[model samples]
Target: MDLLGGAALALGTVVVVVVGGGIVALVVVARRVRSGAIPRFGGTGIHELTRRAGTLLVRLDDRLRDADSELGYAIAQFGADAAKPWADALSGARAKVAEAYRLRHALDDAEPDSDRRQREWTLQIIALCEQAERQLDEQDDAFTRLRGREVSAEGTLRELRSRIEDARARAAASRELLSDAAARFAPAALAAVADHPAQADRLLDDAAVRADAAAAGIAPSGVSSVSGILAEAEQIVHRAGDLLESVERTVRDLEAASAALATRRRELAEDATQARAEVESAPDPDSGAAILDALRELEAITPLSPADPVRELDRLDEAASRLDLALAGSRNQKQRFAHALAAYEGTLVSARSQIAVVRDLVAGGRAGVSARTRLAEAERQLAIAEAETDPVEKLDAVRRAVTHARDADALARYDLGG
Candidate 1:
């Protein structure tokens, strides 16, 4: 009897364990449903719900299409002699029906992945179908009111249909114009605005996509939305044309500036050569040593190159200004060097103030890496200037320091817009 009792107790324990495991599994499934990882369709399975939704949408679309066709037939039989009020009512109803059908088809094709989204879409399609039915009922009422009147409802609908056809035609023409602009001018704009060709192409491509959407919205039956879309297409086409023209103008301006820069470069080279000769032939070689050093500094700067012509031109201009100062020292000798040194001392003071301001800007995150680098270089140059024994070399170093400090300040405040 004791052995029998032990077996019964072990069997009860196993049953309890199995029940606990089942409960845990059920809790996990409940959490998944709540989190939307698994669909909560009440008692209905996901596949069954989706099939029902699709069937409902298909039936709604077919009914809406049939209503639209009946209206179209009525309009064709009536001709332009229909009363204006009745025809307007009929056309509005027809448009609503067409929109409903379009919406239904779009939803059907969407094939929503989530159960929540699928349910939402299904509800929306049902609402649209109901709205379309109301519109058809209103159209019927309008026809009944106008029955036996001198103006037939059919005549007015025919006139309305013709107007819609004209609007569609206009929309088609606008679409064609946009397409032509994309084909003809987009590539040229890309080539002309080499610096920002991607931006140009993106704008054109976006406009093209909009145009295609507008074209698709243009139905055989009139839709008020088509009018707005056509207007948008026209505007997009005009914008593209303007963009191409602007790009062309910019290209021309750059070419002209390049030619002018070439001429200026040649002039600068000649002046530099003449200045070097004057310094070398000076009677007192010791007095002209600073001027000779300045010349060497100028020579150390890289020459103008095609890769960065604008920046190279700026460098050339700075060099030319320094060379002019050196040329003056070569002619006046010691007295001139003294005067230049005094001037450079003032410049050094100004530069130090500018560098301090730039440092603050850098700390505030308003300045860039280039600004910090230039500030460091300016400080180094200032130290070299102070340590120099010769007045001429001191003046040259001070001037270079001032230039670098001013450049750092400018860079700190440079506008990215340009």
Candidate 2:
């Protein structure tokens, strides 16, 4: 054969083998599909899942129905309003269970073209089943809680009654205590209770009414009302006790303050007398005039009856302190004046000696006219210092004399070239 015929033959052989293999594969696939040996894409598995989910949903529905019946019975035994939430939960669960059943049926009947859609339906059914199961569990939990409340209802009522009775006893005791206190103390002292006695009595009465209402099985609100009323009663009793204590404390404080005022008044009188003596005995009575006037004013003060005596006492204390300060200042001023006088005398003597020295320098012609003028000025200052009566002015004159005299003596020596 030629090269082209050989190549054509090889190509035809390859084509035949490929076609034959394809036909065999098709046949095997067809057989498997017909015989149910091969699993359909998302078909068998999804169907099994749907069946299982449907079974679980049916079982859950049955349980929910039973639970609903029980809840209904409980409502009947108790009140319809009491178990309303539980009934609503059970109804919701039943509705979801029904939806789960419908989705499961759709999953089972879906066509091959709708395999993905059927899987989605299967998933939805599972979710609905789980949601329904959760709802059923909620119902169960609610029912359990309701039963527990029912079991404890009698005990709660008994406890409420006991609390109300205790509150009543306490209120009675408080009222008795208030009455006794009112009798023991003056009416004015118990003015707080007197002002609001009606309100306090009303609190107790309201508590009694609430307690009666609770005992009559009105509602839980009745119990809450009782608690509020009892709280008000307690507050009233506490206020009354506080008022009594305040009145008693006020009385005691007034007594103590009155006694202190009397003692302070006596002390103030004695302080005024002593301040007068100090003013008279002061070294410089003229300087103590302000203090004596203050003492007189303190002695003249008289507090009106029922007026605050502390103000009067404050005035007296201020006056006494002023007298003490004034006395001390007067003594200090006297001592200062004496010392100034001594210093001024010493300065005058020194000035005179310097003037004499300057005069001798001028007489010897060693000092010039300037020294004579300074010496004359020094003598004039020294005369002024001696003639001055005010100690402070005298000291000023003496200081001036000393300065002028020293200057004159220096000029005289400088003229002598010594």
Candidate 3:
């Protein structure tokens, strides 16, 4: 009986120690959570922070876009020098927003392993958002002060009417422009800007309706309401103007592409001659064939053909780049470097043109995720190319930018059913 009692007592003691240790661990975990050293997955603190951060991030991004449009108007109303302060404000806000996006992207790309790190990142995002909001608010306040809050409804209404009238005139011209472009280029080539004039007309009609409503005193809050309605109408008119401008820009781009094709044809002939000599010495059949293929492609393109000079330029550039890479294997480093240095500027120009076209298309609402992603990457690569010191690296970056830009254009066109 004595031995049995001793054994039972020892077992009880062991159970108590195990339960006590568990209790101590729970207390420590609870304290750490309260102190924010540990995150509560189910807790409202981090969740609410994340939600608020996301909302503010989106809001700030939208405000930045609106500010960009407003800046253009500001420049129109007040000269560029006078609009400098607003421009500076926009620049500052953009910087903050960019950093915030980087943080958000990092968070999304791969979350931190620790809950504490997650909370910290969330807090940082929230802080950045708040900072951007404050920056924009200050700029808005300055703008309000500049306008003196004394913009009479009559004055605003007149301005809106004048802008709408100007838009209508431009819209007429844009239709003519589109007609000319359509006659010259393929429907797919002009697809990005084909309906811009009609779309602008519809937007102008909506702005006119809003203007009429403002004149009828149908707004909610007297003068403020009238001002608000006029502001919205003005924005719509500006949007219409932007659409018309896009048509003009597209025509300009097409003309530029045609001119570039003429220049590239001459250059291609020169490149083929040089490539043939190099291959004869180095015996690179593949490189020689690439140049020949590019030449054939260019030769096939006559002025009378349904010429897509932009696409042709891309193909020719790609082929030339392939030959360059192939030849680089045989050349000394110094020769390759010298060649890259000379070619980088022209390559950069082509890449920029390609990126700009697709960027405008994406902004016009024809972008899918894949298109947007490629466009962003292209832009990123272009920046890198511009900043890079090594000629070879810069040229490579430009090539990558061009490739990504082309992919973005294809995807956007597919999305647009063009």
Best by TM-score: 3
What would the per-residue lDDT of candidate 1 be over residues 167-240, giving only the tens digit for each residue?
A: 44444444444444344333322232333233434445555565556555444543213333344544644444
Per model, state how many residue pairs clash: 5, 0, 0
Candidate 2 regions with alpha-carbon error over 4 angstroms: 1-52, 113-115, 172-418
The list of candidate 3 runs beyond 4 A from truth reads 1-151, 218-224, 283-304, 329-349
Model 2 clashing residue pairs (backbone): none
In order, the Cα lDDT scores of the candidates are 0.52, 0.56, 0.71
Ranking of all predicted structures according to lDDT, beginning with the best and ending with the worst: 3, 2, 1
Cα lDDT tens digits for candidate 2, 1-418:
5322443454456445545564454345446545655334344487686676678877886786567457657655456555556666665666556555555554456445365555555555666677778876876787676556544554554655565455455545555665665554444333333423344445545545654554454345331212323334445445444433333443343334345556656655665565566676666757568768777666676764433332333344345445445555545676446545644544454455445545545755667888888888888988888899988678677667766776887788788785
What C-alpha RMSD separates each model from the true structure? 22.8, 38.1, 19.5
Q: Poorest 10 consecutive residues of model 2 by lDDT?
A: 221-230
Best by lDDT: 3
- When sorted by TM-score, best at the front, the candidate numbers are 3, 2, 1
| Model 3 per-residue lDDT tens digits across residues 1-418 | 3322443454456445545564454345446556766444455586687798799889988887777678777665444665666766666566656655655665677545366655656665666577767877887787676554324666678778988998899999989888877777877667777888899999999999999998886333333335556778889998888888778877887778777766766676766676666766665676666555655554555554566666666666666676676666556788777767656655665677678778778887857999999999999999999999988999899989988988999998888786
Model 2 per-residue lDDT at 281:
69
**What TM-score against the true fold does each predicted structure earn?**
0.30, 0.35, 0.59
